[model samples]
Target chain A: MGLNIKPLADRVLVEPAAAETTTASGIIIPDTAKEKPQKGTVVAIGTGKKDEPLTVQVGDTVLYGKYSGSELKLEGNDYLIMRESDILAII
Target chain B: MGLNIKPLADRVLVEPAAAETTTASGIIIPDTAKEKPQKGTVVAIGTGKKDEPLTVQVGDTVLYGKYSGSELKLEGNDYLIMRESDILAII
Candidate 1:
Protein backbone atom coordinates (compact mmCIF):
# COMPACT_ATOMS: atom_id res chain seq x y z
CA MET A 1 0.00 0.00 0.00
CA GLY A 2 1.33 3.47 -0.90
CA LEU A 3 -0.96 5.43 1.40
CA ASN A 4 0.89 8.04 3.47
CA ILE A 5 -1.73 9.47 5.86
CA LYS A 6 -1.41 9.02 9.63
CA PRO A 7 -4.20 8.99 12.16
CA LEU A 8 -4.15 11.29 15.19
CA ALA A 9 -5.18 10.99 18.83
CA ASP A 10 -6.09 7.35 19.41
CA ARG A 11 -7.62 7.11 15.95
CA VAL A 12 -6.94 4.19 13.65
CA LEU A 13 -7.11 3.65 9.92
CA VAL A 14 -8.66 0.44 8.78
CA GLU A 15 -9.21 -1.28 5.46
CA PRO A 16 -12.59 -2.90 5.62
CA ALA A 17 -12.99 -6.47 4.53
CA ALA A 18 -14.65 -7.06 1.21
CA ALA A 19 -18.39 -7.34 1.45
CA GLU A 20 -19.64 -10.90 1.43
CA THR A 21 -21.52 -11.69 -1.75
CA THR A 22 -22.29 -15.28 -0.81
CA THR A 23 -23.42 -16.98 2.36
CA ALA A 24 -21.53 -19.85 3.99
CA SER A 25 -23.99 -22.26 2.43
CA GLY A 26 -23.00 -21.06 -1.05
CA ILE A 27 -26.20 -19.13 -1.46
CA ILE A 28 -25.78 -15.88 -3.35
CA ILE A 29 -26.77 -12.90 -1.27
CA PRO A 30 -28.63 -10.00 -2.79
CA ASP A 31 -27.04 -6.58 -2.61
CA THR A 32 -29.89 -5.24 -0.52
CA ALA A 33 -29.26 -7.89 2.16
CA LYS A 34 -25.52 -7.31 2.32
CA GLU A 35 -24.56 -5.77 5.63
CA LYS A 36 -21.52 -3.57 5.95
CA PRO A 37 -18.51 -5.57 6.98
CA GLN A 38 -17.72 -5.06 10.64
CA LYS A 39 -14.22 -6.46 10.51
CA GLY A 40 -11.12 -4.81 9.04
CA THR A 41 -7.36 -4.79 9.05
CA VAL A 42 -5.59 -2.02 10.88
CA VAL A 43 -3.49 -0.05 8.46
CA ALA A 44 -2.30 2.82 10.64
CA ILE A 45 -2.54 3.82 14.24
CA GLY A 46 -2.25 7.04 16.22
CA THR A 47 0.36 7.64 18.89
CA GLY A 48 -2.39 7.84 21.46
CA LYS A 49 -3.12 10.67 23.89
CA LYS A 50 -1.00 11.54 26.88
CA ASP A 51 -0.91 8.82 29.53
CA GLU A 52 -2.72 6.43 27.19
CA PRO A 53 -1.19 3.80 24.99
CA LEU A 54 -2.78 2.11 21.97
CA THR A 55 -3.43 -1.59 22.18
CA VAL A 56 -4.01 -2.50 18.54
CA GLN A 57 -1.11 -2.68 16.14
CA VAL A 58 -0.74 -2.51 12.41
CA GLY A 59 -1.92 -5.65 10.62
CA ASP A 60 -4.11 -6.60 13.55
CA THR A 61 -7.69 -7.57 12.62
CA VAL A 62 -10.21 -5.55 14.57
CA LEU A 63 -13.96 -5.47 14.98
CA TYR A 64 -16.00 -2.30 15.22
CA GLY A 65 -19.55 -1.03 15.03
CA LYS A 66 -21.20 -0.90 11.62
CA TYR A 67 -21.74 2.85 11.90
CA SER A 68 -18.44 3.76 13.51
CA GLY A 69 -15.68 5.88 11.96
CA SER A 70 -15.41 8.42 9.16
CA GLU A 71 -14.86 7.19 5.64
CA LEU A 72 -12.17 8.45 3.30
CA LYS A 73 -10.60 7.37 0.06
CA LEU A 74 -6.83 7.04 -0.36
CA GLU A 75 -5.02 5.73 -3.37
CA GLY A 76 -8.36 4.52 -4.76
CA ASN A 77 -8.91 2.47 -1.59
CA ASP A 78 -11.51 3.11 1.09
CA TYR A 79 -10.51 3.43 4.75
CA LEU A 80 -12.11 4.31 8.04
CA ILE A 81 -10.68 6.59 10.70
CA MET A 82 -12.04 6.23 14.20
CA ARG A 83 -11.11 6.42 17.85
CA GLU A 84 -9.61 3.32 19.44
CA SER A 85 -12.54 3.10 21.76
CA ASP A 86 -14.80 2.62 18.78
CA ILE A 87 -13.12 -0.70 18.19
CA LEU A 88 -14.95 -3.44 20.03
CA ALA A 89 -12.29 -6.13 20.01
CA ILE A 90 -9.05 -7.30 18.46
CA ILE A 91 -9.37 -10.48 16.47
CA MET B 1 -30.63 11.83 44.26
CA GLY B 2 -30.34 8.78 46.52
CA LEU B 3 -28.51 6.60 44.01
CA ASN B 4 -25.34 5.08 45.41
CA ILE B 5 -23.75 3.40 42.43
CA LYS B 6 -20.22 4.53 41.59
CA PRO B 7 -19.03 4.25 38.02
CA LEU B 8 -15.79 2.41 37.46
CA ALA B 9 -12.83 3.63 35.44
CA ASP B 10 -13.65 6.57 33.17
CA ARG B 11 -17.38 5.81 33.14
CA VAL B 12 -19.96 8.43 34.03
CA LEU B 13 -23.61 8.36 35.08
CA VAL B 14 -25.81 10.92 33.46
CA GLU B 15 -29.38 12.00 33.97
CA PRO B 16 -30.84 12.49 30.53
CA ALA B 17 -33.06 15.44 29.84
CA ALA B 18 -36.72 14.83 29.14
CA ALA B 19 -37.50 14.20 25.48
CA GLU B 20 -38.69 17.27 23.64
CA THR B 21 -42.33 17.01 22.76
CA THR B 22 -42.73 20.42 21.16
CA THR B 23 -40.96 22.46 18.54
CA ALA B 24 -39.58 25.98 19.09
CA SER B 25 -42.76 27.46 17.61
CA GLY B 26 -44.97 25.51 20.00
CA ILE B 27 -45.79 22.90 17.40
CA ILE B 28 -46.25 19.47 18.94
CA ILE B 29 -43.89 16.79 17.76
CA PRO B 30 -45.21 13.29 17.33
CA ASP B 31 -43.76 10.55 19.47
CA THR B 32 -42.26 8.90 16.41
CA ALA B 33 -40.39 12.11 15.63
CA LYS B 34 -39.06 12.61 19.15
CA GLU B 35 -35.35 11.97 18.85
CA LYS B 36 -33.52 10.80 21.88
CA PRO B 37 -32.12 13.70 23.91
CA GLN B 38 -28.37 14.03 23.49
CA LYS B 39 -27.86 16.43 26.38
CA GLY B 40 -27.76 15.52 30.03
CA THR B 41 -26.45 16.42 33.46
CA VAL B 42 -23.62 14.60 35.12
CA VAL B 43 -24.79 12.90 38.24
CA ALA B 44 -21.79 10.75 39.07
CA ILE B 45 -18.30 10.33 37.67
CA GLY B 46 -15.54 7.78 37.88
CA THR B 47 -12.00 8.32 39.04
CA GLY B 48 -10.80 7.92 35.46
CA LYS B 49 -8.16 5.61 34.14
CA LYS B 50 -4.67 5.52 35.52
CA ASP B 51 -2.72 8.71 34.66
CA GLU B 52 -5.88 10.25 33.22
CA PRO B 53 -8.19 12.50 35.18
CA LEU B 54 -11.86 13.14 34.64
CA THR B 55 -12.50 16.52 33.06
CA VAL B 56 -16.21 16.87 33.73
CA GLN B 57 -17.47 17.29 37.26
CA VAL B 58 -20.75 16.67 38.99
CA GLY B 59 -23.55 19.03 37.97
CA ASP B 60 -21.94 19.70 34.62
CA THR B 61 -24.11 19.51 31.51
CA VAL B 62 -22.75 17.31 28.77
CA LEU B 63 -23.42 16.26 25.22
CA TYR B 64 -23.11 12.74 23.83
CA GLY B 65 -24.07 10.70 20.81
CA LYS B 66 -27.71 9.77 20.47
CA TYR B 67 -27.02 6.04 20.77
CA SER B 68 -24.05 6.15 23.11
CA GLY B 69 -23.98 4.48 26.51
CA SER B 70 -26.03 1.82 28.32
CA GLU B 71 -29.44 2.64 29.72
CA LEU B 72 -30.58 1.85 33.21
CA LYS B 73 -33.26 2.81 35.67
CA LEU B 74 -32.68 3.62 39.29
CA GLU B 75 -34.96 5.19 41.82
CA GLY B 76 -37.55 5.18 39.06
CA ASN B 77 -35.43 7.58 36.98
CA ASP B 78 -33.65 6.73 33.74
CA TYR B 79 -29.89 7.21 33.49
CA LEU B 80 -27.09 6.44 31.10
CA ILE B 81 -23.71 4.96 31.89
CA MET B 82 -20.92 5.50 29.44
CA ARG B 83 -17.20 5.96 29.19
CA GLU B 84 -15.94 9.49 29.58
CA SER B 85 -14.66 9.34 26.04
CA ASP B 86 -18.25 8.78 24.89
CA ILE B 87 -19.07 12.27 26.06
CA LEU B 88 -18.61 14.60 23.12
CA ALA B 89 -18.43 17.83 25.10
CA ILE B 90 -19.13 19.48 28.40
CA ILE B 91 -21.63 22.30 28.18
Candidate 2:
Protein backbone atom coordinates (compact mmCIF):
# COMPACT_ATOMS: atom_id res chain seq x y z
CA MET A 1 0.00 0.00 0.00
CA GLY A 2 1.14 3.52 -0.77
CA LEU A 3 1.36 6.22 1.90
CA ASN A 4 0.54 9.88 1.46
CA ILE A 5 3.31 11.44 3.51
CA LYS A 6 5.04 14.71 2.73
CA PRO A 7 7.98 14.90 5.05
CA LEU A 8 9.32 18.32 5.97
CA ALA A 9 12.60 19.59 4.63
CA ASP A 10 15.50 17.18 5.16
CA ARG A 11 13.28 14.53 6.70
CA VAL A 12 13.06 11.02 5.30
CA LEU A 13 10.76 7.98 5.39
CA VAL A 14 12.38 4.62 5.82
CA GLU A 15 11.05 1.07 5.81
CA PRO A 16 13.20 -1.10 8.04
CA ALA A 17 13.83 -4.59 6.80
CA ALA A 18 13.43 -7.62 8.98
CA ALA A 19 16.60 -8.49 10.84
CA GLU A 20 18.62 -11.48 9.74
CA THR A 21 17.77 -14.71 11.49
CA THR A 22 20.67 -16.95 10.46
CA THR A 23 24.27 -16.48 9.51
CA ALA A 24 25.60 -16.87 5.98
CA SER A 25 26.99 -20.33 6.74
CA GLY A 26 23.64 -21.56 8.00
CA ILE A 27 24.71 -20.92 11.54
CA ILE A 28 21.70 -20.21 13.70
CA ILE A 29 22.58 -17.21 15.78
CA PRO A 30 21.43 -17.37 19.31
CA ASP A 31 19.44 -14.52 20.79
CA THR A 32 22.53 -13.37 22.65
CA ALA A 33 24.10 -11.82 19.57
CA LYS A 34 25.52 -8.47 20.60
CA GLU A 35 25.60 -6.80 17.23
CA LYS A 36 22.19 -6.11 15.75
CA PRO A 37 22.11 -5.26 12.10
CA GLN A 38 20.63 -1.88 11.16
CA LYS A 39 19.45 -1.65 7.62
CA GLY A 40 16.48 -0.17 5.75
CA THR A 41 15.23 1.26 2.45
CA VAL A 42 14.30 4.81 1.74
CA VAL A 43 10.64 5.34 0.94
CA ALA A 44 10.29 9.15 1.03
CA ILE A 45 12.67 12.03 1.54
CA GLY A 46 12.16 15.63 2.55
CA THR A 47 12.97 18.56 0.29
CA GLY A 48 16.18 19.17 2.23
CA LYS A 49 15.99 21.76 4.90
CA LYS A 50 17.28 25.30 4.48
CA ASP A 51 20.13 24.83 6.91
CA GLU A 52 21.49 21.44 5.77
CA PRO A 53 21.04 20.65 2.13
CA LEU A 54 19.79 17.18 1.40
CA THR A 55 22.68 14.84 0.72
CA VAL A 56 20.48 11.80 0.08
CA GLN A 57 17.53 11.40 -2.25
CA VAL A 58 14.49 9.21 -2.24
CA GLY A 59 15.03 5.53 -3.09
CA ASP A 60 18.48 5.54 -1.54
CA THR A 61 19.33 2.77 0.91
CA VAL A 62 20.43 4.07 4.28
CA LEU A 63 21.63 2.95 7.72
CA TYR A 64 21.00 4.54 11.09
CA GLY A 65 19.94 4.07 14.78
CA LYS A 66 21.87 6.58 16.83
CA TYR A 67 19.15 8.57 18.58
CA SER A 68 15.42 9.15 19.15
CA GLY A 69 13.15 9.34 16.10
CA SER A 70 9.43 9.20 15.52
CA GLU A 71 7.92 5.97 14.22
CA LEU A 72 4.80 5.87 12.11
CA LYS A 73 2.57 3.40 10.28
CA LEU A 74 0.96 3.90 6.90
CA GLU A 75 -1.53 1.48 5.46
CA GLY A 76 -0.26 -1.84 6.88
CA ASN A 77 3.40 -0.96 6.60
CA ASP A 78 5.72 0.33 9.31
CA TYR A 79 8.00 3.28 8.70
CA LEU A 80 10.20 5.80 10.38
CA ILE A 81 9.89 9.45 9.34
CA MET A 82 12.62 11.59 10.84
CA ARG A 83 14.77 14.60 10.16
CA GLU A 84 17.64 14.18 7.74
CA SER A 85 19.99 14.83 10.61
CA ASP A 86 18.85 11.62 12.21
CA ILE A 87 20.10 9.57 9.31
CA LEU A 88 23.76 8.54 9.77
CA ALA A 89 24.88 7.19 6.43
CA ILE A 90 23.71 6.18 2.96
CA ILE A 91 24.61 2.58 2.36
CA MET B 1 38.93 9.91 32.81
CA GLY B 2 38.87 12.64 30.13
CA LEU B 3 39.07 12.86 26.37
CA ASN B 4 40.52 15.49 24.10
CA ILE B 5 38.12 15.50 21.20
CA LYS B 6 37.03 18.53 19.27
CA PRO B 7 33.85 17.63 17.45
CA LEU B 8 33.18 19.37 14.14
CA ALA B 9 30.09 21.39 13.40
CA ASP B 10 26.87 19.98 14.89
CA ARG B 11 28.55 16.78 16.00
CA VAL B 12 28.31 15.57 19.54
CA LEU B 13 30.29 13.36 21.95
CA VAL B 14 27.93 11.18 23.90
CA GLU B 15 28.62 8.85 26.82
CA PRO B 16 26.22 5.97 26.46
CA ALA B 17 24.61 4.83 29.64
CA ALA B 18 24.56 1.18 30.49
CA ALA B 19 21.35 -0.54 29.43
CA GLU B 20 18.86 -1.56 32.03
CA THR B 21 19.21 -5.15 33.15
CA THR B 22 15.93 -5.70 35.02
CA THR B 23 12.36 -4.46 35.31
CA ALA B 24 11.29 -1.92 37.90
CA SER B 25 10.32 -4.72 40.19
CA GLY B 26 13.80 -6.25 39.89
CA ILE B 27 12.53 -8.78 37.44
CA ILE B 28 15.60 -10.05 35.63
CA ILE B 29 15.20 -9.79 31.88
CA PRO B 30 16.34 -12.64 29.74
CA ASP B 31 18.75 -12.04 26.91
CA THR B 32 15.86 -12.44 24.47
CA ALA B 33 14.39 -9.09 25.41
CA LYS B 34 12.98 -7.63 22.23
CA GLU B 35 13.02 -3.98 23.23
CA LYS B 36 16.50 -2.56 23.54
CA PRO B 37 16.82 0.74 25.29
CA GLN B 38 18.68 3.62 23.64
CA LYS B 39 20.05 6.24 25.98
CA GLY B 40 23.17 8.38 26.47
CA THR B 41 24.56 11.64 27.81
CA VAL B 42 26.14 14.48 25.86
CA VAL B 43 29.71 15.09 26.84
CA ALA B 44 30.58 17.39 23.97
CA ILE B 45 28.86 19.16 21.06
CA GLY B 46 30.05 20.45 17.75
CA THR B 47 30.03 24.01 16.48
CA GLY B 48 27.06 23.06 14.29
CA LYS B 49 27.50 22.75 10.55
CA LYS B 50 27.11 25.47 7.96
CA ASP B 51 23.59 24.44 6.99
CA GLU B 52 22.16 23.54 10.40
CA PRO B 53 23.56 25.68 13.15
CA LEU B 54 24.72 23.84 16.24
CA THR B 55 21.63 23.20 18.36
CA VAL B 56 23.49 21.51 21.20
CA GLN B 57 26.52 22.28 23.29
CA VAL B 58 29.00 20.58 25.59
CA GLY B 59 27.47 18.87 28.62
CA ASP B 60 24.04 18.83 27.01
CA THR B 61 22.53 15.36 27.25
CA VAL B 62 21.44 13.89 23.91
CA LEU B 63 20.10 10.67 22.40
CA TYR B 64 20.98 9.16 19.02
CA GLY B 65 21.69 5.90 17.13
CA LYS B 66 19.92 6.27 13.81
CA TYR B 67 22.72 6.19 11.25
CA SER B 68 26.43 5.52 10.72
CA GLY B 69 28.80 7.79 12.57
CA SER B 70 32.50 7.74 13.28
CA GLU B 71 33.51 5.76 16.34
CA LEU B 72 36.52 6.92 18.27
CA LYS B 73 38.44 6.02 21.37
CA LEU B 74 40.49 8.39 23.44
CA GLU B 75 42.78 7.16 26.16
CA GLY B 76 40.99 4.09 27.56
CA ASN B 77 37.36 5.07 27.01
CA ASP B 78 35.18 4.38 23.97
CA TYR B 79 33.11 7.06 22.29
CA LEU B 80 31.08 7.69 19.19
CA ILE B 81 31.67 11.16 17.77
CA MET B 82 29.39 11.79 14.85
CA ARG B 83 27.70 14.64 13.05
CA GLU B 84 24.82 16.45 14.65
CA SER B 85 22.65 14.98 11.95
CA ASP B 86 22.83 11.63 13.71
CA ILE B 87 21.54 12.97 16.99
CA LEU B 88 17.81 12.35 17.50
CA ALA B 89 16.84 14.32 20.62
CA ILE B 90 18.14 16.45 23.48
CA ILE B 91 17.11 14.72 26.67
Candidate 3:
Protein backbone atom coordinates (compact mmCIF):
# COMPACT_ATOMS: atom_id res chain seq x y z
CA MET A 1 0.00 0.00 0.00
CA GLY A 2 1.77 3.13 -1.22
CA LEU A 3 0.54 6.70 -1.56
CA ASN A 4 1.33 8.91 -4.53
CA ILE A 5 1.18 12.11 -2.50
CA LYS A 6 4.48 13.13 -0.93
CA PRO A 7 4.79 15.22 2.20
CA LEU A 8 7.14 18.18 2.20
CA ALA A 9 9.26 20.29 4.55
CA ASP A 10 9.59 18.00 7.54
CA ARG A 11 6.01 16.88 7.14
CA VAL A 12 5.03 13.23 7.03
CA LEU A 13 2.23 11.08 5.71
CA VAL A 14 0.72 8.57 8.12
CA GLU A 15 -1.94 5.95 8.09
CA PRO A 16 -3.80 5.94 11.43
CA ALA A 17 -4.51 2.69 13.20
CA ALA A 18 -8.08 1.50 13.44
CA ALA A 19 -9.95 2.64 16.55
CA GLU A 20 -9.84 0.10 19.34
CA THR A 21 -13.12 -1.71 19.90
CA THR A 22 -11.86 -3.83 22.80
CA THR A 23 -9.60 -3.23 25.78
CA ALA A 24 -6.68 -5.42 26.77
CA SER A 25 -8.81 -6.94 29.54
CA GLY A 26 -11.37 -8.10 26.93
CA ILE A 27 -13.96 -5.48 27.81
CA ILE A 28 -15.82 -4.24 24.75
CA ILE A 29 -15.76 -0.49 24.27
CA PRO A 30 -18.79 1.27 22.88
CA ASP A 31 -18.59 3.34 19.70
CA THR A 32 -19.22 6.54 21.68
CA ALA A 33 -16.28 5.75 23.94
CA LYS A 34 -13.80 5.30 21.14
CA GLU A 35 -11.15 7.99 21.07
CA LYS A 36 -9.11 9.01 18.07
CA PRO A 37 -6.17 6.69 17.77
CA GLN A 38 -2.85 8.34 18.51
CA LYS A 39 -0.81 5.66 16.85
CA GLY A 40 -0.07 5.43 13.13
CA THR A 41 2.34 4.01 10.61
CA VAL A 42 4.57 6.30 8.63
CA VAL A 43 3.81 5.96 4.95
CA ALA A 44 6.06 8.73 3.76
CA ILE A 45 8.37 11.44 5.14
CA GLY A 46 9.84 14.69 3.91
CA THR A 47 13.42 15.54 3.13
CA GLY A 48 13.50 17.38 6.45
CA LYS A 49 14.72 20.83 7.29
CA LYS A 50 18.08 22.00 5.99
CA ASP A 51 20.12 20.43 8.75
CA GLU A 52 17.67 18.27 10.66
CA PRO A 53 17.06 14.90 9.11
CA LEU A 54 13.96 12.98 10.09
CA THR A 55 14.40 10.21 12.66
CA VAL A 56 11.40 8.21 11.49
CA GLN A 57 11.43 5.97 8.44
CA VAL A 58 8.67 4.58 6.33
CA GLY A 59 6.99 1.62 8.06
CA ASP A 60 7.83 2.99 11.54
CA THR A 61 4.96 2.84 14.00
CA VAL A 62 4.70 6.15 15.82
CA LEU A 63 2.67 7.90 18.47
CA TYR A 64 1.54 11.47 17.97
CA GLY A 65 -0.62 14.11 19.62
CA LYS A 66 -4.31 13.35 19.49
CA TYR A 67 -5.02 16.68 17.80
CA SER A 68 -1.99 16.74 15.65
CA GLY A 69 -2.13 16.39 11.81
CA SER A 70 -4.72 17.27 9.19
CA GLU A 71 -6.95 14.48 7.98
CA LEU A 72 -7.34 13.75 4.31
CA LYS A 73 -8.67 11.00 2.08
CA LEU A 74 -6.91 9.73 -0.99
CA GLU A 75 -8.41 7.01 -3.14
CA GLY A 76 -10.88 6.39 -0.30
CA ASN A 77 -8.11 5.78 2.21
CA ASP A 78 -7.68 8.07 5.23
CA TYR A 79 -4.31 9.54 6.10
CA LEU A 80 -2.81 12.33 8.15
CA ILE A 81 -0.32 14.98 7.16
CA MET A 82 1.72 16.67 9.85
CA ARG A 83 5.15 17.91 10.71
CA GLU A 84 7.57 15.43 12.23
CA SER A 85 7.57 17.36 15.48
CA ASP A 86 3.93 16.39 15.93
CA ILE A 87 4.98 12.75 16.31
CA LEU A 88 5.61 12.05 20.01
CA ALA A 89 7.58 8.81 19.73
CA ILE A 90 8.45 5.82 17.59
CA ILE A 91 7.25 2.44 18.73
CA MET B 1 13.98 45.56 30.71
CA GLY B 2 16.24 42.56 30.21
CA LEU B 3 15.69 38.98 31.35
CA ASN B 4 18.38 36.60 32.57
CA ILE B 5 17.03 33.61 30.69
CA LYS B 6 17.90 32.78 27.13
CA PRO B 7 15.60 30.76 24.89
CA LEU B 8 17.11 27.63 23.33
CA ALA B 9 16.80 25.82 20.00
CA ASP B 10 14.38 27.91 17.95
CA ARG B 11 12.52 28.96 21.09
CA VAL B 12 11.75 32.61 21.70
CA LEU B 13 10.93 34.64 24.79
CA VAL B 14 8.02 37.01 24.35
CA GLU B 15 6.19 39.67 26.33
CA PRO B 16 2.56 39.44 25.29
CA ALA B 17 0.42 42.48 24.75
CA ALA B 18 -2.27 43.37 27.24
CA ALA B 19 -5.75 42.10 26.48
CA GLU B 20 -8.03 44.54 24.73
CA THR B 21 -9.98 46.74 27.06
CA THR B 22 -11.70 48.80 24.39
CA THR B 23 -12.67 48.24 20.79
CA ALA B 24 -11.63 50.58 17.97
CA SER B 25 -15.17 51.91 18.03
CA GLY B 26 -14.84 52.91 21.74
CA ILE B 27 -16.91 50.06 23.08
CA ILE B 28 -15.50 48.75 26.33
CA ILE B 29 -14.88 45.01 26.37
CA PRO B 30 -15.49 43.32 29.69
CA ASP B 31 -12.82 41.16 31.24
CA THR B 32 -14.88 38.03 30.66
CA ALA B 33 -15.10 38.88 26.97
CA LYS B 34 -11.41 39.59 26.52
CA GLU B 35 -9.55 37.02 24.48
CA LYS B 36 -5.92 36.13 24.87
CA PRO B 37 -3.73 38.54 22.95
CA GLN B 38 -1.99 37.10 19.90
CA LYS B 39 0.54 39.90 19.54
CA GLY B 40 3.77 40.22 21.50
CA THR B 41 7.26 41.65 21.52
CA VAL B 42 10.17 39.33 21.18
CA VAL B 43 12.59 39.56 24.09
CA ALA B 44 15.10 36.88 23.19
CA ILE B 45 15.50 34.15 20.59
CA GLY B 46 17.31 30.88 20.27
CA THR B 47 20.33 30.18 18.10
CA GLY B 48 17.89 28.22 15.96
CA LYS B 49 18.32 24.73 14.59
CA LYS B 50 21.62 23.62 13.08
CA ASP B 51 20.90 25.31 9.75
CA GLU B 52 17.67 27.25 10.12
CA PRO B 53 18.38 30.67 11.58
CA LEU B 54 15.50 32.49 13.27
CA THR B 55 13.87 35.33 11.36
CA VAL B 56 12.61 37.25 14.42
CA GLN B 57 14.80 39.51 16.49
CA VAL B 58 14.69 41.10 19.95
CA GLY B 59 12.21 43.98 20.17
CA ASP B 60 10.39 42.77 17.08
CA THR B 61 6.63 42.78 17.44
CA VAL B 62 5.16 39.53 16.17
CA LEU B 63 1.81 37.87 15.78
CA TYR B 64 1.41 34.31 17.04
CA GLY B 65 -1.28 31.76 17.70
CA LYS B 66 -3.43 32.55 20.73
CA TYR B 67 -2.60 29.16 22.25
CA SER B 68 1.01 29.02 21.13
CA GLY B 69 3.69 29.37 23.87
CA SER B 70 4.06 28.33 27.48
CA GLU B 71 3.34 30.93 30.16
CA LEU B 72 5.94 31.85 32.75
CA LYS B 73 6.73 34.61 35.21
CA LEU B 74 10.14 36.01 35.90
CA GLU B 75 11.00 38.94 38.18
CA GLY B 76 7.31 39.59 38.69
CA ASN B 77 6.71 39.91 34.95
CA ASP B 78 4.76 37.47 32.84
CA TYR B 79 6.14 36.13 29.57
CA LEU B 80 5.65 33.36 27.03
CA ILE B 81 8.21 30.94 25.68
CA MET B 82 7.62 29.15 22.37
CA ARG B 83 9.20 27.96 19.19
CA GLU B 84 9.77 30.60 16.52
CA SER B 85 7.59 28.56 14.20
CA ASP B 86 4.68 29.34 16.50
CA ILE B 87 4.90 32.94 15.42
CA LEU B 88 2.71 33.55 12.41
CA ALA B 89 4.01 36.87 11.17
CA ILE B 90 6.05 39.93 12.02
CA ILE B 91 3.97 43.00 12.76
Q: Which candidate is the best by lDDT?
A: 1
* Winner by lDDT between candidate 3 and candidate 2: 3
Clashing pairs in 1: none
What are the per-residue Cα lDDT tens digits for candidate 1 across A2-91? 445446558788998777766454534344554533778899887777979999999998878777776554455666677899998886
- Candidate 3 CAPRI category: incorrect
TM-score of each: 0.45, 0.44, 0.44
lDDT of candidate 2 at residue A79, scale 0 to 100: 85
lDDT of 1 by residue, B1-91 (tens): 5579999999999998776644332322223332322667899999999988877788886656568899999989999999977764443
RMSD of each: 11.1, 11.9, 11.5
Q: What ranges in model 3 sit over 4 Å off?
A: A1-91, B21-37
Candidate 1's docking class is incorrect
lDDT of 2 by residue, A1-91 (tens): 4568888877888887666554232222223223322446788887876656676677776545534358887888888887766654453
What DockQ, on C-alphas, does every prediction get? Answer: 0.02, 0.04, 0.02
Interface RMSD of each: 14.7, 11.6, 15.7
What tens digits encode model 3's per-residue C-alpha lDDT throughout B1-91?
6588989999999998777554332322223322322667899899989877877889987655567889999999899999987764453
For candidate 3, what's the RMSD? 11.5
